[model samples]
Target: MASTLKAVGRNVLFGLLMAAAFPIALAAQPSHPSQKVTVLKVNNGQEVLVEINGEGRAVRLACIQAPLEQQQPWANQARTALSNALPQGSVVEMELRARDVYGRVVARLLKEKIDIASPLISRGHVFAYDGYLGRCDDLNYPRLERQAQRSKAGLWAVEGGVSRPWDLIEASGRQTQP
Candidate 1:
């Protein structure tokens, strides 16, 4: 009981710190035209390190959420899928949406005009992020996710898909305030 209380306190403190440190408002507007950028590395399923203007930047893929590392094979598989899609040194078009609290660019990535998040959602490698769909194609993403769920693809192949990343974080005594 004492440990649980401590965990809760830590989570609350962390949330307060995050909220105070990054208070920038995110605009729910369409992103700017695509800008060519080189992929530096795949950070996870929904994020990557890229080079823009000869400077390194972290980009969070908009409209999707993938398994967290603690979720094991699914997380690794999601990361691998993203890595395959955006291999190191590969140049892609990035449509900038907004900067996230962590200072990562939240954007939609495209290769040959193909929206990368589409395939990931359709394959069930990631969940259509419902929380922040204001800047995305709200309808299309959820539709793709539903189709993937119906077909039991990728992470959804199990009896039920793995716990959502945010839920997993919450279960671990962490707060996902974004």
Candidate 2:
């Protein structure tokens, strides 16, 4: 019985070691590779349409959801803010991740090596999106969001400022029903 228990313990330890090593290996593999593209338009704070290799592709900002244009206090601001940061005809680098349900390639846009999401999230223009893939570690997002909330920056300045787009969509769905 002692020998059997020892074998089991060894197996468990091996399994734990493999589990811990998996993510580090995956991180080394680079889930999203950087690609240069021309910015056709900033769809919103969290989405942009770009021309890559002469093809137009919609890229949603990974790990964030900006308010829609109708969300009052945030919608229009989000769009305008993104537009200002990435103007038309601007060339930028995109770290492309997997696609969403809408077929847009989720990515992190970088202009002059500066991450575009930083300004949006830090200023309270968007939220630290929790719906993205868990394995993709976006460091400093939670910290930036907390600072924005504490400072009452951008949309956070208004009462009930941090309303998510998904929640607003759901609320509108309920309102329109018979």
Candidate 3:
């Protein structure tokens, strides 16, 4: 009986060691952020509704948070802006930050050398998602964002200026008027 108990203990230790190895190996792998995805939809800002390959999953645009559909001056405009940014055959490079509760890829998207997320913020089409603002890591987004706001660029052109994407998501699903 004692010998059997000792064997079980050894197996548990081996199992724990094996489990630990997987994550470390995965982490060691380079962050191949970009994926071959098609633009399925584009909300205001850089929030693109995309269809990812491999899993063929539809996910919200990663990184910066764009205004919701109804909140924009023209709900369609929100989509149009993103559509213009990422046209058909556009392949985005996404640095997978994490997966939200819904399993969507929350990432910092890129197009060539341009950091896609920053442009959305600086362009005033989207805001730094307050939930994970993270100091606007790559770009000096705040300064550019200010310029966009002052100029009333894109979504900022609305009446009261702009509203946070999170606020729009949180508020009743009503569109904001200019």
Query: lDDT of all predictions, in order shown?
Result: 0.85, 0.81, 0.62
Write out the backbone clash pairs for model 1: none
Best by TM-score: 1
Q: 54-165, model 2: which lDDT tens digit per residue?
A: 9999888888778766677687888888999999999999987677777888888889989888889899888877557652475567788889999999989988676677
TM-scores for candidates 1 onward, in order: 0.77, 0.76, 0.61
Question: How many clashing pairs per prediction, in order?
Answer: 0, 0, 3
| Model 3: CA > 4 A from native | 1-46, 49-53, 133-136, 168-178
Candidate 3: clashing pairs of residues: 33-94, 34-94, 44-78
Model 1 alpha-carbon miss at residue 66, Å:
1.0
Q: For candidate 1, which ten residues in a row score worst on lDDT?
A: 22-31
Candidate 1: tens digits of C-alpha lDDT, residues 1-178:
9999999999999999888766443344343766999999999999999999999999999878988887889989889899999989999999987788778888889998898889999988898986663676533898999999999999999896788887777677976533
Worst 10 residues of 3 by lDDT: 130-139
Tens-digit per-residue lDDT, 1-178, candidate 3: 9999999999999999999999999887655455656665554454556666544454555445655555646445555666777886677776666566666666666677576656666667676553452423444556667788888877787788766756765566754321
- Candidate 3's clash total is 3
* Model 1 alpha-carbon drift over 4 Å, by segment: 1-31, 175-178
Residue 10 miss distance in model 2 (angstroms): 38
